[model samples]
Target: MAAMQNITVRGVALCDKKRAGNVHVELYEKDVLDPHDLLNDTHTNLQGEFKLYGEQDELGTIEPFIRLTHNCKAKPGCMRVGDYVVPTDKLGGVYDMTYVPLDIVVSGEGEQCI
Candidate 1:
């Protein structure tokens, strides 16, 4: 389904081939994305195992999905969907695609939005 300006993506963190952490969905534009930008809503080690819900201008599913990027944090993992790097024994887990209903808290913009 083409969500035009908004979409919901559900995912989970796979560590040691097992789901270790809850999945997250963040809206970031490549031209202006940094680790610090995302660290605001959730807390996690550089390993990236957390969940967050934020609104972004879809801009049509920005490249190198945030899902794969977070998954690759487990040593030798790097956005394998499009930016896959050589796999290493650092963490022997894999990613899983799941559909968890994340209700949209707001459809319109909000004030005090960081």
Candidate 2:
């Protein structure tokens, strides 16, 4: 059996350096053969700041990441999604991302029209 592992992440979501509120932030644990496990999720406050913490019991080290969904200057009826991975060594404590600018598309960023 494995012990429960935990993670804490906090940051501000911005678009062109301005606060981007209501952005959906999700924390997930990477899994090899199954769908990624959703640990926690929340929306940034009016200040564009968010804080999330989650825990899971796994046989191996937890590979965690944060996925952000936002409109951030996208055309109406479109949204952009980005994923920021956390270093495995950063688990079990707070990892402050500080600021995540949404204006710039990050690696693996995808756009969805809805």
Candidate 3:
């Protein structure tokens, strides 16, 4: 059997059509103060959907869950081809994660973690 350190995290990402560019996600414990994480580059994508998995450390401390949901909100006039992903105007993103126990079922309020 795998060691108790075998903890996994999984999730899906969705964004509006206006939101373009790639997305990134990282995991962390509930309380942590840091801009970077030990588990670097947990999530990355060139498509619309995003998923990630990682292990936990002692004290059950997982890396911070980071995400890039929005990008390239700027583009003067119009850029032809797939070159629409240009950062010039404005960009915003949301970051969150749901912790699930592998040993038991979890009851929640809503789907998508928010």
Per residue, candidate 3 scores C-alpha lDDT tens digits across 1-114 of 322232233434333332222544444323355444334344334443444443444454333333332222223442211101112121122222332211221232112212
How many clashes would you count in candidate 1?
3
For model 3, the local distance difference test gives: 0.32
TM-score of each predicted structure versus truth: 0.32, 0.96, 0.37
Model 3 residue 105 CA deviation in Å:
29
Candidate 1 TM-score over all chains jointly: 0.32
Best by TM-score: 2
Candidate 2 residue runs with Cα over 4 Å from true position:
none
TM-score preference between candidates 1 and 3, better one:
3
In order, the Cα lDDT scores of the candidates are: 0.32, 0.94, 0.32
Local lDDT at 54 for model 1: 35
Pairs clashing within candidate 2: none
Candidate 1 Cα deviation (angstroms), residue 109? 32
Residue-wise C-alpha lDDT for candidate 1, range 19-71, written one tens digit per residue: 44333344333444544223113333333344333334434443222323233
Better of 1 and 2 by lDDT: 2
Question: Highest lDDT among the candidates is held by which one?
Answer: 2
